[model samples]
Target: MSTSTRAGSAAPSIALNFDSIAAARAIVPRLAAISERSEQLRRLDDEAASLLRGSGLARVITPRAFAGLEMSPSAHIRACAEVAHGCAAASWVLMVCVAHDYVIGRFPEACQKEVYEGDADNLIAGALAPQGTLERTPEGWRLNGRWQFGSGCDHSPWLLMGARVANPEAGGYLTYHVVVRQSDMEIDDTWRTLGMRGTGSKDLVARNVLVPDHRAVPTYPTFIGQSPHATAPTYRLPVFAGLPCMLSGSVLGMAEAGLEAFIGHTKSRRDVTGASKSANANMQQRVAESSAEIAAARRLLESACDRFDVAWRR
Candidate 1:
């Protein structure tokens, strides 16, 4: 698909592709096992994260020119859901990491070149919440602040931090996506949660770090597709259009897991009336209804994704 040229115009030429679906499927069992372990560890272990990297999971959304999959958005969503069914934390980390590539691609070519030059598989971990401060410096900008909820931070070599740039005229905040080497930020192990514990999302602290001007991308300009990389068709796609889908895909996967567990339970469980759960007509109806509901919901989700995919590919 050709990249779009018009400013603020999204390129609707990318098509959905699933050549990597089998590869993704092969890793599901392993991912599920590691997911349980990650929950116990309260973070994804290096070994498991490595497995994902090795499995080509991290490259799903990478541009084809960068030796990454450059897959269609639909395929990306499906892959995320599959992994999520096995482990939501693992899937969440993978989704964010992959999505970062797409976001970074919307930057200037120089920035993209610097990021994907050697290893396209390089992992990026961080958040979009504007939590840091950028002060102008001679060389570039001095960044200082603390960003929380950096998922998969333990394995990333580069971190993308969101911070507010002081706008004197507007008397407001302008968000910036600042690229920092992993060494520049200190990782604080503060991820303790009842759910999604395996994510090991922690806080990242940056203190008086100098970031070159080219390393920072403004968020306000990009919302309307007026980014430095807007000339590239890949950069024209709406940022919010695909993110929620990625998150929802993981939720759908978890729901599928719950449904499966319920099905298994129903087969063996007996109700208070001492009747076999599976043999009870009402229980059978409930299970059937639940199955239908899940199927319908999944179909609706996929259909919406397909519609977006078609538009994106046009």
Candidate 2:
């Protein structure tokens, strides 16, 4: 299908679905198994990545036309939270993957087709920070430089890189999104961290990789909703409006995981003050407070997502 028509026809609905929750549950154990390995290796294991792909968890934010679930932002948030309950790094990777799909949807239809049409389930990894240089080339442009914090690189088949095209006439830099196949670039294993180690977020280097004009998107234009893609109602929605909610969902999930651990510890813990931990007023109060905090955070996230849906409808 043509990219424009496919984008228009595949505009995502704002409603949440049961499948998203089910996917979250099914992937939680897989995340747990790989959590330790990710920490030890400072990256996600191949097994965990495959499991996530098999679970269709990565498709939550993918456009429906691309065989994605087209889940509402709220659903995406909830799912990430559930995954974070098992492993923060896994949840973070899932959040980034889903967000990257959303960003790709906002690109020119040609770009979308080039990245997703052949293998709708292909994993894409890279940092969004604009740190590379773009020099004009005959076909499109040659991208050069390095980007760090590329999460899920070990499992991704493609990388989405951000670079600046120097507009001498305009006397400024124009940020652009460039797609490079995995083979064209190098992945550096430098993901040392105190937490969220399984993310495998390292650095990506692109040296004079040629990208076609159809595949390069100007970042600023997208911010104002001037994407090359046709304006479907979904496309008309603000660029990156759903991203923060997705990130917050992962944080909320990790918090929930901490709460669970606290509960487990308290159940059998003895207070240092001689009182039974569960019987102590302070411990009871802490448990109540944590539960309330988690509940409040969930409500806030859902409310924000609800607002995003309402905005999209307009």
Candidate 3:
């Protein structure tokens, strides 16, 4: 467990000077150039990762008081979608990092200061499924297990993992979470997939690591918009429900990218009968249908995100 070095220090209340969506757009070209390289390496390229960090898109959901933009849900979705247009893997990592920042905000103020006080841009990797076993102790909880699908763990300094904790009073186990430094865990290079291979969804193993009480957070409260800063609209929203929405943007963007590629290839394709695809009625119908589907899906996802934005503001 890593503690804050600045003794008796308060969390910084500085504001960031960057637009989340615009920063994402600026990095699109770099991500696009390295999309294939990322897939081959089974993680994000170094250059692309540097560009993304410099762009300041990873802190979109970080609290503004910590020098983060803390953009709205809809804006965050748009930023992910924009980055996904260049590379789905890059966008996946970006979403994972940003989402973890939001999760960090749900913890106690002391936990927030420990993470953000030293480095505002500290990326956090997370595995949502409760895979670890937790036992209560005087200091805190003892965690030992392996978490899978640790997406974007390559660049994160902290890891947010889920575990099943014993309930002495209730005689049943409940899911809980603890934040730990990346150095406390071991990464297993077991992520090999067909699509989205660049996500680096590796396995993180922790053996008998002790997490302090202040670093622990309950599950139910976080899901129901309970936070230290509950008065703020962003923290008040049902933050967990927004996870699927956060991921939907990348799916839509990837589908759109695939559709565009198919259309471009079709224009130069020739049928067995020696007719160019651009001149073939059947190919034209297929392209039109695919384009319509992509457009409609985009509209639906964007509409849902718009509704989320409305709810956040209210």
Best by lDDT: 3
Estimate candidate 1's alpha-carbon lDDT, on a 0 to 1 scale: 0.73
Candidate 3 segments exceeding 4 Å error: 1-18, 168-173, 229-231
Give the Cα error of residue 114 in candidate 3, in Å: 2.0
Candidate 2 clash pair list: none
**Which pairs of residues collide in candidate 3?**
none
Q: What TM-score, to 2 decimals, does candidate 1 have?
A: 0.86
Question: Which is better, 1 or 3, measured by lDDT?
Answer: 3
Q: Local error of candidate 3 at 41, Å?
A: 1.1
Each candidate structure's count of clashing pairs: 1, 0, 0
lDDT score of residue 229 within candidate 1: 65
**Local accuracy of candidate 1 as per-residue lDDT tens digits, 1-314:** 22222222332333233344565677888887777789888888676787678877787666555666555466667777787767778878887777787677677666666777667777788887889887776787788898888988888888878888755233233677888888888998898889888888999999998988788877777655567564544455677777777667777777888788888888888889988888989878887898898788789779867865665554
Instruction: Please say which candidate is ahead in lDDT: 1 or 2.
Output: 2
Model 2, C-alpha of 270: deviation from truth (Å):
1.8
The TM-scores of all predictions, comma-separated, are 0.86, 0.88, 0.89
Sliding window of 10 residues with minimal summed lDDT for model 1 = 1-10
The parts of candidate 2 lying over 4 Å away from their true place are 1-18, 168-173
